[model samples]
Target: MEKDKWDKKITYPDLYLQFGSEERSFFKEEAKHLKAKYDELGSFCELKKFTGGHDYIKWNEEFVKTISKLLKT
Candidate 1:
């Protein structure tokens, strides 16, 4: 979705996205689009790219890192 199409009246929470470099093209494009939209809207958004694929183990590690970072904020 485009940034202009987003509802400005509704508040959006901070976005934290974790994606693998070896992930599918479609998913990566979607994440990039979302990040672009958030950037255009001037909202807080983070996108972390890892050198891996769609694996649960990596996701679990990223999840822990995300949680830890969130906790520190």
Candidate 2:
């Protein structure tokens, strides 16, 4: 097996199995903004919300639901 470009080094192309393009982009942009904010603030702990926090969590829960649905299909 090969290492991934990102940290945690999961198998390449495997993340796509868990996310669609838009979902992946959303995560990427969120992470990017978090990094930039961290750099400016001199700390990386504050995860500024790009979207509403509750909505984001709810959406993720739905995403898990979708995954479950897909698995059941």
Candidate 3:
């Protein structure tokens, strides 16, 4: 991975992330890194954690919530 690409300061669209409580450790770490990167770039980023694992039911619920948030914004 290119360090400059990852560290570049540029405009970015709003980000909304949904993670499950039982998600893999690697995924959680990646999410945290992304949040930090977005923050460093002065972009809007939200990370929401739910009490569930990687499944369709949880995904469906989070999808609806994400849509609602986007619509409201």
Candidate 4:
């Protein structure tokens, strides 16, 4: 079966119950926001790698690092 066709078997609630109601709600909200952001980013898919000129090596490296940092956030 395709991965996308599969339902989520369980959720955060089914895990440890030490979380209070507020914490659980916050976790769900944050998860929703992150999911929306990733979907938005996925919609702007890149077609191909942008190869850089030799002279732009430093600039390209810095650009990649910045993108990585942004993704982490």
- Compared with the true structure, all predictions reach lDDT values of 0.85, 0.45, 0.81, 0.39
lDDT of 3 by residue, 14-63 (tens): 88887888999877877788788889888888988889877779978888
Kindly report which residue stretches of model 2 are placed more than 4 angstroms away from their true locations once superposed: 1-23, 44-73
lDDT (tens digit, per residue) of candidate 1 on 24-60: 9987988899888788778878998898988889989
RMSD of 1: 2.1
Clashing residue pairs, candidate 3? none
- Candidate 4 residues 1-73, lDDT tens each? 1223322442322111111233345654544554544344443222212333323564466567656966799
lDDT of 2 by residue, 7-71 (tens): 33332221211222344566656555545544544553323233333355656765677668669
Q: Once model 3 is optimally superposed onto the true structure by TM-score, how far is the C-alpha of residue 15 displaced, in angstroms?
A: 0.8
State candidate 3's TM-score: 0.82
Ranking by lDDT: 1, 3, 2, 4
Ranking by TM-score: 1, 3, 2, 4
Residue 57 of model 4 has an lDDT of 61
The list of candidate 4 runs beyond 4 A from truth reads 1-23, 43-73
Candidate 1, run of 10 with poorest lDDT: 1-10
Q: What value does the lDDT take at residue 50 in candidate 2?
A: 35
Better of 1 and 4 by lDDT: 1
In model 3, the worst 10-residue window by lDDT is 1-10
